[model samples]
Target: AAWKAFLNVSQSIIAIAFGAWAYESLGGTHGTPLESNLVAFFGLAVAFFTTNMISVSIFFVIRNKNTFLSVLRQVVGPGGINIVYGLLASPIALIAAFLYDKLYVGGILLIILPIFLIRYSYLSKIQLQQSNQDLLKVLVKTIETRDPYTSGHSLRVSRLARFIALELGLSARRVEMIETAALLHDIGKIDSVYAEIIRKRDRLTDEEHRVIKTHAVKGAELLQSLTSLPEEVIKGVRHHHERYDGKGYPDGLAGKEIPISARIIMLCDSIDAMLSDRPYRAALSVDQVAEEIQRCAGSQFDPDIVAVVLRGETLEKAAAQIREASLPDVVGV
Candidate 1:
């Protein structure tokens, strides 16, 4: 916390210095005409905002030991809302400063309400996004409670899917969509109808297995009821079971017919399943899991995505992370 505060203060100081240098260098004298000073004012604002963002971004990169682009994504917020807020606030701040210079305390008081309103609006939007995610997590937790054997399954899949999506060089928006879809992929199992099947220790009979297959479409329908989920997310949950060769399930979306998010989740879901111990089988080693994924490519999994997973250390890194944090130990261990 202290280090963050220090960085913030440093950022402010650097921005202020840059703004002052820009204002003076742009030739704004004490009695300059409003038209002439406008250029200098704009220059000062640009310098301040740019300097501030750069300083803060640098601090985040060093502090987190992450890449600049990743830090930039965090600072900009999803969809660049934070950047929009900063742009909106910049002009307001300049207007406030001008008013204060002209009318002293009265000018300051006049713009105070507007400043607060803008700040409040930005915060409200952020809070609303966070609340929505929390609601999704609560729903996931409910599903977890319904079947203890699959504890942390969704989270592990989500984490692995995120890593795979990143490895595939997907855009930030696509990554978020894939991660969210993976997290809710099994949400349909939350329904009481699947309680017995999910909790059953023995092998499922054909009838019970058929019932379980409905979960993909069921999850999509349940999420569709929310009305706010994106179409990609709905398709991901609906088609995750679909095989690449079109032999899999609920609609049998073949090849690229399945959404990219669904394809990523399908592979990740299977990976986690192999890594986790079930009543019927022990968890497979990482090498064994990789071999299975390779064996299934172009049939059960997307060949392209499987290639990405096998490239470099992506699969190993993803598996290591999930085993260490996102998933429970193998049942006996």
Candidate 2:
């Protein structure tokens, strides 16, 4: 944290210095035309914004031990609203300068309140996003905690889904949504009503099976009521159980009728389940999983997705990742 703080202060200082230089170099202090002043102010804002983005991106790359491009994608990618807010806030300094020139001390004082308010609001937004993410982690943990047999299940599925999405040449935004959906795909199992059904060792009765099928819809409803998540994510959770041939689940969605995210997640979910050991069956080999998928294609699973899984080391890669990340079951925890 202290290192991060130092980096933050350093980046701000560097950005401010660059902005000041650009402003002065553009004849900001002299009797300049209105057009020139506008140019100078925007130049200053751009200088500050660019420098700050670079410095912060570098810090994130180093701190997270991730690649620079990954950091860039997060800042400029699909859900980078915070970065947009920062860009919008960059112009506020120019506004402050303009006010100061017009009304001197009074103008400066007048702008101070708004400046603080904007800063406060931005901070609050950051805090809220952080809190929401923390809450999501807790929920994922709780979901796994409820059913001991599936410890670390959601996380593995999420990773596998991300890999599959990337392999399928999906956009980064779509991949992110798919990963999130996979992580929360089984959230319905966390419902109080699912407690006994989830923990039951024996095979489910016809009634129990029917009740279990409602989980996909229930999970979607839970996300809708509790989160401001995207509609795609909700639909992904809702339709994950639908069969490609229209024979499965609460929605029997067939082929292209199913959302792509749901399609990808449904396959990934099955892959994880097939690979994991359950009371009724031991974990299957990667080859066996591939064979099962191949056999079920066009009926239970999306044939196109099944093809992707069977293609050139794709299933191997996904299975290797899950195996590498295997954790102890949370049976008693």
Candidate 3:
């Protein structure tokens, strides 16, 4: 992220410098104080505007979890940023043609292009957000169908995750993404080698355990194909199982290396899973589950996130709600 920011800053500086040079070459003598002042002001504005667009683009990319190209395309799509830019630039282009002729046309083009580019970026973000939600719904449905015992597990987890995110002061949009990711965190189970273990109300085989563990990787692969999701979201989906002590699967990312969203999902997922009965285990009481989570802080969970959850009144209510909505033994069987 820092590198991207640096590149944006550099590009803006270069553009402003080139614009100043071109203006001077086009008979605006820098020797005159008034001309110099105008050139400086224009260059500064261009730089400022360019940097502003870059910042917005970055934010859009993070918000949507989309590739840069996708973001650009959306912002420019139909009556969006592109149209706004075209409206602003068309007159400038016409004026340039009439005044200094084609020599100044390039300047007008540069000014107009960023408009379309930035608009496309913003639009792409909207598309990405919509796509993520749609994909999440599908994933959650698939997981729920596979395990009748956990029919509403994903939904409860999402609610719990969202509450925790809000408690941590995450933005509404971020909380939404975290919720979506939580809803689909177990999606990798679709390809699980332990499908029978999940179905049979008995102990899982060693091989079944191994297969169950592959869900994180599978879920990440599924999300990666969408192309509209952000890297952080993908990481969260992939590493939700990772322990803070670096004992987790796929890549054993520990502590801060684990994406914050993933950390949020991990705690919520565990809490929900523990509070709900599974074929192999009885449902733990809310107090027991909370104590377990607190005991494992800095080992299985992030301490800071655990702290937030502990203080969250909504979290306890969410857990109790999950218990109330518990599935019957027929669903588990």
Best by lDDT: 1
Using lDDT as the yardstick, the better of models 1 and 3 is 1
Tens-place lDDT per residue, model 3, 60-113, is 778644455444434444334544564455345335434444347576676667
Clashing residue pairs in candidate 1 are none
* lDDT value, residue 221 of candidate 1: 93
Q: Regarding TM-score, does 1 or 2 come out ahead?
A: 1
Instruction: List, residue by residue over 99-146, the lDDT tens digit for candidate 1.
Output: 877899999999898768989999999899789988998889888886
**Candidate 2 lDDT over residue span 1-333, tens digit each:** 997788788889999999889988876766654455877777787778778877877887676444565566555554555556666776666677677788898988898987789989999997996797668767888878766668778887888788677656565678888888888998888788888888889989999988888888899988999667889999999999889999877777899999988888888888888888889889899989989999999998889878866765666766776677674556874
* Model 1 spans with C-alpha error above 4 angstroms: 15-34, 45-47, 50-67, 70-85, 162-177, 244-246, 291-299, 302-333
Q: Say which candidate scores most in TM-score.
A: 1
Q: Estimate candidate 2's alpha-carbon lDDT, on a 0 to 1 scale.
A: 0.80
In model 2, where do residues sit more than 4 Å from their true spots? 9-35, 54-71, 78-87, 103-105, 122-146, 155-183, 190-193, 203-207, 222-230, 243-248, 254-257, 271-275, 281-333
Give residue 197's error in model 3 in angstroms. 3.1
Task: Point out the higher-scoring one by lDDT: 1 or 2.
Answer: 1
